[model samples]
Target chain A: MPTTTRQWLLNGHPRGRGIEIDNDFRLVEAELPDPGQGEMLLKTHYLGFDPAQKGWMENIADYVAPMNIGDVMRGSGIAEVVASNGGRFAVGDMVFGTTGWTEYLVTDGKELTRVETELSPTAVLSVLGTTGLTAYCGLFKVGKPVAGDTVLVSGAAGATGSIVGQLAKIAGCRVVGIAGGKDKCDWLVREAGYDAAIDYKAGGVKEQIRELCPRGVDVIYDNVGGKILNDMLACIATGARVVICGGISRYETGSLPAGPENYFNLVFRRGTMAGFIVLDWASEFPGIRKRLEGFVKGGSLKYQEDIQHGFENAPQTLQRLFTGQNRGKQMLKL
Target chain B: MPTTTRQWLLNGHPRGRGIEIDNDFRLVEAELPDPGQGEMLLKTHYLGFDPAQKGWMENIADYVAPMNIGDVMRGSGIAEVVASNGGRFAVGDMVFGTTGWTEYLVTDGKELTRVETELSPTAVLSVLGTTGLTAYCGLFKVGKPVAGDTVLVSGAAGATGSIVGQLAKIAGCRVVGIAGGKDKCDWLVREAGYDAAIDYKAGGVKEQIRELCPRGVDVIYDNVGGKILNDMLACIATGARVVICGGISRYETGSLPAGPENYFNLVFRRGTMAGFIVLDWASEFPGIRKRLEGFVKGGSLKYQEDIQHGFENAPQTLQRLFTGQNRGKQMLKL
Candidate 1:
C-alpha cells in the first residue's frame, strides 16, 4: 500500500470571475491517512468534475458551504477502501462519496455509499448517480413534462442536461437540445435520440427555437442560464414549466449585465420558472436509482462520459468543463 | 337621454415610452348609438383606470388586442342600461362591462354583468370587479401564503397590491408593503392593516426589506418589476414563491438596461417565480367573488378609491396609475 498521498487544496479564492489554476489551487504531498474508530481509509479511483465546483471555490455560501482557503477542494469521486477500522465499509469494497480532489482520504463512513458492483463506476457516477437523479427529479417535479410536450434543454451535452433530454423523451415528449458546436449538437440528435438540436455557437438560437417549436416550448430544462434563458422565455407555450438545473454560463462570470429580459412573458404565458438543488430530493433518490437503472437495462436511456486520466490533471479537467472542451460527463480517472 | 356622447379616441400609439395626453388621445363628440336586436345601449356611470390599460395602448399585443389608432380607449366601467331590444338587460338596470372611455356604449349584453344593488357602484369596480378577482386569485393561487410566512408586496398602495396585502394578512401571513411615499406607507399599516410598510421613495428598498424580513421574505407579490424586484430576489427565503402581478416600473421605460440581476438565487433558495393573467382564472372568479365579499362583509378587508370627475379627464386619470399620484384604485365618474 502507498505510504504517501497526493492532494489538491484550495490555495486562494478567485477574487474575480475566472479562476486561475496555480493561483487558486495548490498540489501537495501528505502522509497516507490512518483510519480512526468507525473510520476507513479510501483511495480515490476516479474523481468527478462539475461546473458547480466553480461556485464552491467562491467566497459565498450556496446550497453547500463555501470552501475556505487551505481546505481540500471538496468534490465527489469513486474510491476503493484500502484500510478499515470497525466501520460500515471493508477493505477492497468500492464506494462513492465526497472523496474530493485527493488520491487518499479517511472518513467515518457517514458520507459514503457503497457502490453496486453490477454497473461500471462511470455508469454509477453518470446515469445511476446524482446526475441521473437531478435530471429525472428536475424534469418530473419541476418541468412536469407531459406526453407530446415540446421539451427544450440548454447545455444538452453536459452531464445532467444530456440525461434530462433522454428522460423527457422517455416521458413521450419531443426533445430539443441546445448545445455548443456542431459536434455536440450532431451527437445529441444522432447518438442521444434528440428530436432536434440547435448549435448555439452559430448564433440565431432565438430564431431556431421559434422555427422548430412553432407551438412554443411546453417545458424548458435550463442548465445554461442568461441570454439563452432570456431567449427561451420569449418562446414558451402557455403554462410552460421552466426547470433551472444549473447556470453554467454565468458560473465563471461573477456578475452579468442582466438576467432574463423577457421574464415578463411568464405572466403573458401564465408560466412557472422554478429552481431546486438535487440534495433536496435525497429522500426519494433510492426510488430514482431503481427507475434509472430500469431505463438503462431496457436499452432506453444512453449516457456518455469523457474520462481524463491522472490525479495531476484534476485542475485542468475542471477547467475543460468551463471552456466546453470536455465532452459528456467530465471525469478524471486517477 | 343625451343625443351627443363624448368619447376619447386613441389618436396615436406612443412611439416612445411616455404617453402624451394630447398627442396620443383626442376627445370628440359622437352621436349616441341605438340598440339593435339582442343589443342594449348603456350609459357610462364610472370608468376604471388600470396600469394594464397602458399595455393595451401599446402597439404590441398582450392579454388583449392593442387599441387601434382611431378606436375608443378600451376600459372597464359601471354602466346603466338605458334601452334594450330583446336583450338580457332591462331599462334602469345597473351593469358592469367594458364601457371604454365613452359616455354611451351599444353592447350585446354578453360583455355585461348585472351589479349587486346592495353594494356601492364604486365598490363594484374596486372590491368586487376584475380588480378584486385579480387580488384574491393572485394572492391565494400564485403567492400561496402559509401562516407565519413573510409576504412582501410591491406597489402596495395601488389597487391590486393593496388588496393582495390585505388578503395575505387574512391568510395569516406577516404582511409588509412597499409603497412610494410616507402617506401611502402610513395608510398601508394604519388603514390597510399591513404588519409594516416600506417607503420606497426613501430609497434603500433592499436594505429596508432585509431589515423588515431578517429571516428573508417567504412570498413576494411584485407589481413593480425591475430594480425593486431585483432587490427582493436577494432577500428571498429558501423555498420562496415570487408572484408577478404587474411590471409598472418598466411600463414607461420601454426598454430597460437590464432585468433582475440576482435571479439565480432562485436555485440556491429553491424558489419558484410565476406569473399569470387574472382572466385565465375566469372559470373560478365566481368562487373568488364570494370569498372576497365574505372578507369585506366580515370587516377583514378594506379598500380605498381615488375617484376623479369628468369623462374628459379619462386620459389624465389613466396617467395617475403610472405617476403614483392616485391614492388607491384610480377611477373616473362621468
Candidate 2:
C-alpha cells in the first residue's frame, strides 16, 4: 500500500511585493520504504513558521544557506519517529530538527533530538526551541540587562519579543514594549507584565518612548530595525546597549536599511550597539532550555500559537508576520 | 605693587571660518591677586592646544560647557604652584588641570592633579595625561583586542592614534595604520611598529583595506569618523569591535558629516560598534597610568609634542590640527 503526504516548497523568490505560492509543492502518494541503516522515517505533527523563513526564501546569503529552487522549505518541526533503523531510538519516538515542511520525512538520524512525550510537543518547537533560545541569547548574552535596568523591546507582541519582555520582567528590570496594535500592546503590558507598551501604529513613537522611559532606555532589544531603531537611539541612556537580532522592516527591500541618524549619541552617552546570532551560543542551550522549560511548565512564561490549518497554509501564515496579522508564534499544523 | 600677568580671553565667537586668530582672542595684562582660602596660584608652563578648543569657542554647547565670551580659553595645562593656602600641596609642587590660557592665575584646589616631576614633565600633559589615557581606555577597554588579532586604527599618526597603534603591537596584534601622508604612514610602520600603513590621502582606501587585511579587520579604533570609518566597516571580520573615541572630521562642519554609508554591515557580520567617553573610565586610570608610566620610563613607548612658541599662538596652533599641519600633540609654551 502507498502512503500519502503533502509538502510545501519555495515557489518563487519574493521581491518587494511578497512571496508567491504556486504549483511547486505537490500532494502525492508513494510506497513506504524500510528504514536504511542509521535513517529514521518520521511523521510530521507541527511545523514552525517564522519571519526568518521569509528571509531564507529571498535567496540572500546570510549566516545560513538560502532555500534552493524547488527544494522542501527548511523549517523546525515536531515529529513522531514511526520507524527507526538503529539503537539511538525505537519506534514511536518523538523528535525534532531542521526538517522540511511535509507530512512525512526521512532523516539520516544525525540532527534529530528525541523529545520527552511528557513535555508538550508544541512547546518543544516554540518556547523550548529556537524561538525561546534566540530570545534568551539576545537578551541575556548580548543585551546583558542588570536588575533595575529599563529594557525596551521592539516587536514586543511577537514570539521572540514577548519572551524577551517576560524574561526582563523576571530579571527585575522595568520593561517597555513596542508593538503594532493596541490589542498587542495591551497584551504585552497586561499579560506579559511589561511596564508599558507603545503602539508603533499610533504614531509619535519617539516622543512616546521618551515619555514612557523617563530614566531613558538602558537596553533596546531590536528586531524591526528602521525608524524604530533610529528613534530608540535618541532615547538611550548612558551605558545603554542596543541589541540587533533582526531587521524585518527592511528585509523585503533587499537592500540595507538606512543607518540610524543619531548614532553619534553613542559617543556622547558612552553606549554600545551589537548584533547577535543565536546559533553562536549553542553550547549554552541546555541551560536556557531548562530554564525556559521550567517557566513554560510553571505558566510563568506564556506563548500564543497562531496556527494555520493544513500544510498548504504555510505560505499564508508567513505572510501574516510581515502584514502584522499574526498575534504570536505563527505555526502551520500538519 | 600688583604683578602684571598676560592672559588670553575669548574676544568673539567665530562662525563658519577657521577660528580667525585676530578676532577670536585678545591678550591683556591683568593684576595678580593673592591665593584666597582653599585656593592656589598657578604659573602656567605649557598650555595644551586641542581641536576641541575650536568647538569650545563656537558659542554652542558640547560635552563640556562652551567658553564664555571674555573668559579665558578653556584648556589643560602643566603649571607650577607659586602659592598655596589649602594643605594639599607645597609651593614647589607641579600640577596639571583645566588651568585656562594664562601665564599666571588663581584657582580653587579642586580639578588639579599633582604631577610627579621625577617622571618626564611633558608626559604629564601628553602621553601620561588625557591624550594617552584616551587612547588606552578606548583601545584596551573598548576595542578589546586579543592576541594575534589584526587591528586597524584611523588617524594613525595623531597623538592618540600613534599610541594606540603601538599598544596594539605590544598586545601581539598585527597593526595596520591609516593616516594622511606618506611620511606619517612611514613613521607609523617603521617607528610605531605597525605591520602596514595605508595612506588615506591617496585614493582606493576600500580596495587597499581589502588587500591588506585579507583575513578582515578584528578591531578598528576610529578617531576620524567620516569616510575612513565607513571604509573600515566593509573590511571588518565577524565579531569585530569599532571604537568611536572622536570624530575630528565632523567637529567643524556646519552640518554633521555623512555617517558610514554601510552600517548595516554590523548586522550581517554579527559585530559591535561602541563609543566611549574617557571620563566614564576615570576610576580605572590609576592602574592604567601606573602601567603606562612604566612603558614610558623603560623607553618602550615614545611620545612627540609639536610645541608652538608663545601663548599668543594658541589659537593658530588649534587651527593647525584641523589643517593637519602639526605632527603630534599640539601645545603652546607660555
**Which one is best on DockQ?**
1
Q: Write the per-residue lDDT of candidate 2 for residues B1-334, one digit (tens) a residue.
A: 2376888899987655567778889988988887788787888999886665766787653557667889988888988888888836678888887888888988785788888745768777778888889989999999999999999999899999999988888788999999998999999888887899999889899999999999999999988887788899988899999898777787656334456646667766789999987878778877888888888777667778988888777778788888888888888787
What ranges in model 2 sit over 4 Å off? A1-34, A58-62, A65-70, A117-119, B1-31, B51-71, B85-87, B90-93, B117-120, B254-264, B283-287
Residue-level lDDT of model 1, residues A1-334, one tens digit each, is 6777899999987644777897889999988767789988888999888787888898674679778999999888999998889978889989997889989888886878889735576777788877898899999999998999999999998888889999998999999999999999999998889999999999999999999999999999999888899888889999999998888878667553258978888888899999899899888987888899889888889888899999999999999998888777889999
How many angstroms is residue A332 displaced in model 2 relative to the true structure, after the best TM-score fit?
1.1
Residues A1-334 of candidate 2 have per-residue lDDT tens digits of: 1154566666666655455555433333444566678877888888887777776777774678867777777888888888778736678888887877878877676777888634567877778888899889999999999999999999999988999999998888999999998999889988988999999999999999999999889999998887888899889998999998887786657555566756767887788999877888888877789999888778778887888888767766667888888877878787
Model 2, residue A258: displacement in angstroms?
Answer: 1.8
Residue pairs clashing, model 1: none
For candidate 2, the lDDT comes to 0.82
**lDDT (Cα, tens digit) per residue for candidate 1, span B1-334:** 6767888999877644877898989999988767789988888999998887877788674567768998999899999988888879889999987888899888897977888735567877888887888888888988899999999999998898899999998989999999988999999999999999999889999999999999999999999898889989999999999999888887777553256867888888999999989998888866777788888889998888899999888998898887888987889999
Question: Interface root mean square deviation for model 2, in Å?
Answer: 2.0
